[model samples]
Target: MYFSQNAIILVMLMFVVSAVFYSTINYQTKAVEDEIKIKEVSIYEKNVKNTIDRNINKIVEDAFVNASYKIMKSRKFFPNAKVAVNYITSFIKNETNKSLKCIVGNSSNITFDVGSFDIEPTDDPLKIRVIGNIELRYTERLNNGEIVGLKNIQIDKEVKLSRIPDPYVYLNKFYYKWEYGRKIILNNFPNDDKNHTFCIILNDSNFNYNRMYNENSPTEIRIIGRNSSTGRWNVVLPYWVQTWREGNNHVSIIWVKVNNKELLNVSEDYIYLLYNSTTPVDREDPENTFILFDNFDYFDPDKWNESGEILINNSKLTVVAGAGSSVFSKDTYGEGYELMFRANFSYTPENNSESAGLFNKLDDTGGYGWAYYGDGDFEIVMGDDSYGIDNTFDYINKTYIYDLILNNISNHPYIEYNIYDSTLNLEYSKRETGSFDGTYPISINALPPENKTSNTNITVDWIFLKDVNNITATVGAENIQPITYTEEKPKTFNGVIYYGVGAYDKVYNGTYSIIGLFTNKSDYWKYPTTVGYKPLIEEN
Candidate 1:
C-alpha cells in the first residue's frame, strides 16, 4: 500500500510541471501578436497624417504664386474679378508639395484713399474721408511657410491677406462690414486725392473757330485753336477738341508736336493774318490811287491795281536804271491789276541814263529786269502822272509799314523779305537763286543804329526821326524834314542816317553822321567803322 501511494504522487507532479510549461509558451505567443498589431497601426496613422500635411502645403504654395503674379505682372489687365479668384483657388487646391488656401470677395464697408485704387468716375467716388467698406480674402498659406518644397517640413505659419476698411459710418461706428464681392478702399491710396472741380472742354475736330475770338484776350476760356482749311493753328476763345476722335490715340494738352518731336503752336495749331483789320495807329494817308481787285487778279505788267502814279506831292517820282525796283506787275500796256501786297518798290527817273522803262511779258525776279529809286531800302507808295524831268524826282509817299494797303492800288511791289542776321553782324544777302533767275542778287546791310534794343520790357517797333517832316508817326502827327544830301552822285548811292542814340527801342534822333556808299546793283555793303556803327542787342 505504501509503494502504490508513492507512484501516484510522482505522476501528479509531472502533470503539474507540463501544465505550467504549456501556459508559459502560450502567454508569450499572445504577447508577441499584440505588439506586432500595435506597431502596424501606429505606422499607418503616421503615414496618413503626413500625406494630409503635404497636400495642404502644396495648396498654399500655389495660392501664393498666383497672388504674387497678380501684384506684379497681371494687375493692369485683369485686376480683380472672377478670373483672379479662380486662378488663386485652383492653385491652392491643385499645387503639389506646398499647401495653400485663398478666397476673394468685396467689402463695401471698407474705405481707402485714391492712389491705391484703380478707380474711374463711374464709381460715384466719394471725396474727403472716402467712406466705404473693404473685403478681405484669403490668398495663400504656403507649405511650411517656406518658398518651395525644397526645404524640410515647415511648421504652421500665418498667411498675409488683403483687408478692406470702412470709412462712412461715423469715426467709431462699426457699420462698416466686409462681405464677398464687395471692396472699398479706405484711404486706399494713402497720398492720392481725386480732384474734379474745374472743367476743361475740348472741341471736336470738325468744329468752327470763326467767331471764337475777336481782337480780345480770351477770358473764360483756357485755350483755343484757330480755323484753317488745313494745318491751321490759332488761339481763340474756348478750346477746340476737334483734334480728338472717338477710340483714337490718346490726345494731349498744352502743345502739339509736328512730327512727334518738333513742338508746334503753344496753344493754337494755326495762325492767320487779319488782312482787313483796322489800319495801324501810325501812318500817312495814301493818295487813294490803289484799286482793290475782286479776284486773285495776279498778272505781270498789270500792277496798276496794286499801285498808281501820284502827280502832286512836294516832289515827283523818278528812278535810276541801275537801281532795281521790284514790282508785282506794271501797267506798261495800260491794264493794271495785282495781288495782295507782300512788299515792293517803283520809280521813274528824270535822266534816261538814270531811268529805263521796264516791260515784262511775264513776271521777273526781285532784282532782275526792274527799276528802282529811293533812299536806302526805300519802300514805295502811289498816286498818278507825276514823272517830271529836270525837276522830276522819285517821290516816296509818306507812310509806315503794317498799314493795310496804303492805297487800293494792288500794282505796287511786294517784298516779303526773308532775311537773317546770322553772323551777329549787319551783313545780309538776297540771291535770285531762290527763284528761277540765278543772276541779279543783292545784299543789304543793317545800318549802324544809334539806339539799341531794350530788355527791360516788350520791344517798341517805332522811333521818330529828326528833320523828317511830313513823316506822320500815326493818324495825326507831322514829321520833321529829313536831313538832305549835299551832293548827289550819278552812279553811287548811300543809305542810312546817323544820329544820337534815342530811348531804347526807338529810332535814333540827332544829326546825321556816318554813311555807306555803294554802286548801283552792287554786291557788297560798306560798314565804315570810321563813322558807321553796327548796333547789337544786349546779351540775355
Candidate 2:
C-alpha cells in the first residue's frame, strides 16, 4: 500500500509540470506572431510614403517643363508684350491640367493649385517666376479614415524669355561736319550745356610736302580761328594744331579747342567757326576725340610712319626688320584709350634670343612694350626691363589678337594686355601697375638673331584705337536696326505674375503650397532716327 501511494504522487507532479510547460510555449508563440504583424504594417507605410514623394517630384518637374515651353513659344511668335503674357498664362493653365492628369493616373480626388505667375522685362530678355502645389488622394485609408496622400508639394522656379532684335537705345555726342564754307560752324550740338571740346581730323589724299608747309598751294588747309561776333573773326592759331606727315601725299593733323579759351567760348549764343583756307575738310568732331582705325586697304601714308622694310598689300602690313628696326605711329595718344591689333610671324626662331612684337609709349629714348620670341616665348618689357616671361606657348605662324588698355584716371596708372589666339582658342592676359607719363606714341619692333636670317617679317592685319570714356551710343542690333526714336526712350519693361495651390482633408483640415511671386524682365529698343545714327562698318 505505501509503494502504490508514492507512485501516484510522482504521476500527479509530472502532469502539473507538463501543463505549465505547454502554457509557457503557447504564450511565447502568440507574442512572436503579434510582433511580426506590427513590422509588416510599418514597412508597408514606409513604401507608401516613398511612392507618394516620387510622384510629387515628378509632377513638379512636369509642370515646370510645360510652363517653360509655353512661355518660350509665346515670346517667339508674339511681338507685343501684353498679348504674349496672356497667351502664355492661358496655355500654361491648360497644359498643367493635362500634365497632372497624366501623372496622377485616373484619380478624381487628385487636384493641383497653380500659384500666381510673375514676369519682369529687361532690355534683352524676360525673367519669369512660377509657384504652386499638388494634392494627391489615394483610395487606401488609415485606421482613422484619413486618406493616404501627399499634400501641398510646393514649386518655385524662374526662367528668362529672350527675343530677337532686342530693344536698345544709343546716344550720339560725336559727329563729323562736312558742309563746305570759308567759316565752318558746327550747329545744333547735342549736350551743349556740358563743357565741350572740338577735334578736327584732317586727311588729304593729294597732300604733298610742299603743300603741307607752304602758304601758296590752293590745296593747303589752314584753320584761322572763331568768329566772336557776326562781323568779327579772330585769327588765333592754337598751339595744339600739330601736323604729322607720312611719305608725301598724306598729312594728318589734330587740333584741340578747349572750353577755357576766350577765343572759343566767347559767348554760348555765338557759334565757334573754323576758317579753312583751301584743303577740303575730311572729318571734324565736336568732342575732341578720334578713333584710329586702319585695315591697310590702301596704304594711308598719313596714318603710319614706316621703318625698316615694310610692305602693305592684300590688306596687311608686313614689317621686315633686321637686328634693330621698328615701325612707329606718327600720332600720339593720351588718357583713356584702347588699342587692338592682330599680328603673326612668318616663322619661329630656334632660340629665345630673337624677339618681335608691338610697343607703346615709344620715344627717342626707350619704351614699354610686349615681345614674342622665335622660341615660342612671350615677354612684357618696361623701358630696358622685362617681366612675365612665358615660354610654354606655341605661337609659330599663329595669328593672335592683342588688346591693350591704359587706365590713367587714378593716381596709380596701369596697363592691361590680352592676347587671344583665335585659331587655337587660347588666351593669355597680364596687367601691370605703375606710373605712366602720357607722351610719345606706339611702335612695332623686331630683332633677328645674329648669323641667322637677315630679316624677320611680322605681319599685322589691322589696328584700332578709341576713347574709352566717350561711348555715347551702342549699336545693339544687327543690320543697323532702329532701337529708339530718341535717346530718352525707355529700353526695358518689367512685370510680375503670381501662382498658388491648396489641399484639404475630409474634415476641412488643409495645407497650402505657394510658388511665391516672381518677376521677368523684357528689353526692347525704340525706332531709330537718322540724326545721331552711325553705321558700324567692318573693313576687309
Candidate 3:
C-alpha cells in the first residue's frame, strides 16, 4: 500500500509539472499575439492619421481658393464691400464641407476655425485686397485618452481684386476777352458793365478813314482816330491792356456789338475776337518820348543832388564819400523806368565796411538800393539794413554795367537789378516783388560805416534812364493781342466740358449713392448748371 501511494504521488507531481509548463507556453504565445495586435493597431492609426492630415490640408487649400474667389467676385460687384470673419468662415465651411464630407465621410472629422479676415480698399482706387488666417482641425476618435488621427491644418491667404473702367465725362469751357490800349472789356459792347460808349473821335482830321454806324444792323463797328492824340470819347477798360503798332501815327478802333442785348446778356461767356492785321505791331518799343542820357562830360548841379567830394574828370564822374555822404538825381522819375550805368570802384576794402552801387527812391533818412559789398557779395538794401542777397557776381575792382528796372505798372509790382559784363552781356539778374516805399529819385552812393577806416570812391562812366512801355504777360494771366475785326468773320470759342459719375458706398447707412458732378472749365462761367440745365446721366 505504501508503494502504490508513492506511485500515485509521483504521477500526480508529474501531471502538475506538465500543467504548469503548458500554462507558461500558452501565456508566452498570448503575450506575443497581443504585441503584434498592438503594433498592427498602431500602424493602422498612423495610416488613418496621414490620410486625415492630407484631407485636412486639401480642405484648407480649397477653402482658401474658394474664399478668395468669393471675395474677389463680391468686391467686383461692390468695390467697398465689407466682409466679416464669420461670413468668410461660413463660406469656407460651406464650400469645403461639400468635398470634405465625401473624403472623410464624417462631418465631425472635418472642422474649421477662421482666426481673422479683412477686406479693405488699397491705395489704388480701383483695387481691393483680402487677407486672413484659417485653421482646419481633422480628428478621429479612439478609446481611452488616445487619439487615432488628428491634424491641425493652417492656411494664410491674400487676394487682390480688380474691375473694369468706370464711366466719366470730360468738361471744360473757353473764355474770350478783348484788350485795347491798356484796357480789357467783355464782348457785350452795347451793355457794358462800365456803361461808357467807346468811340473813336476825330482829333486832327489829317488822315482819311471810314466811320460807319448803323443802329439796326450792329454786329461790329469800325471807327478811326486821327493824329494819335487823346480823343474826346476815351474809355478805359477795367483790366490792363496793351496794343502796339510800328508807327504811332494811325490808330484803328474796333468794337463788337450784339444785335439783341436782351438775348446776349452774358458778356463774359462766348464772345471771341478775330484779329486780322496786315502789319505786325512792334510792342517792344519804349513808351516815353524823352530819355535822360548823360556821359559824365560835365557836372550839372541841376540834374544831380551831390554831397561830399565829387570830381568830374576825363568824362568820368567820381564820388568820394566818408561815413554818410551820397549823390542822387534831383528830378524824380515815375515807375516803369530803368536806370543803367557803368561803374568801377577805385578800391574794395578787405573788411565788410564799404559798399557802392545804384540807390533809388532816396531821401534823407532811408532809401532802397542795390549794392555790392567789400566781401564779394551783392545785396538789396532798404535804408541801412539789407533785405535780400544776390551772390551772383563778386565785384573786385572790375567795371560792370548795372541796369535796375523798377516796374510799378502791373498789379504785381517788382524790381529787377541786372549786372552786365564789360561787353554788355547780361551776367547776373535778380528780381523781387514787393511794395516799394520810396519815390523814384535815382542815386549812386559809396557807403561806409560809422567808424570808417577808409574813404570809398566810385567812378561812373555814363548814366541813362529810359521808360519801359510794354506790359509783361505772366502765365495764367490776361494776355493782350491786337486783332482786326470784320463783319464777315467772327472768332469761335470752343472747349470741352468734363463730368464725373461715381458709385460710392454709404458705409454708415449700408447703402450706395451715385455722385454726378461737373469737373473742369475755364474762368468765364459763374455757375456750372444754369436755371433749367440738366446733365444727361447714362448708366452702363
TM-score of each: 0.21, 0.33, 0.32
| CA-lDDT, candidates in order | 0.23, 0.44, 0.43
Query: What CA root-mean-square deviation does each model show from the true structure?
Result: 30.7, 23.9, 22.3
Highest-TM-score candidate: 2
Count of clashing pairs, candidate 1: 99
Off by over 4 Å in 1: 1-20, 44-55, 63-540
- Over 1-540, each residue of candidate 1 has an lDDT whose tens digit, in order, gives 999999999999999999999999999997896576455434433443355455444344335344443433422322223333345445543442121111111322211111111101111111001111122221223466622111122233232222111111011111111011101111111121221011121223322222223212222122222333443333222221211222232221111111111112343222111111121211111111122211122221333322211111222122112222212222221111111211123322221111111223211213222222323223211121122212112222221111111111233332221111211121222221111222221111111112322111001111110110111111111112111111111211132221113211222211101111111101111221222112211100
Global fold similarity of model 3 (TM-score) = 0.32
Model 2 lDDT-worst window of ten: 509-518
The best-first sequence of candidates by lDDT reads 2, 3, 1
**Candidate 3 lDDT over residue span 1-540, tens digit each:** 999999999999999999999999999998997677556545544544454445444443444344444433444221222332244445545544454344435455445444444433333322223444434444445575533333344433333223222221212121222232111223323333322221121111322222212211212222211111432222211111111111233333222122222121333322222222221221211112125556678977777887666788999887766654566788776456667677875555544322333354212225555565555555656545575455434554677777777777646777777777644447777777765565657677666654663476778887666654331211111223333222212212132222112333222111111111111111111122211112232210
Candidate 1 vs candidate 3, lDDT winner: 3
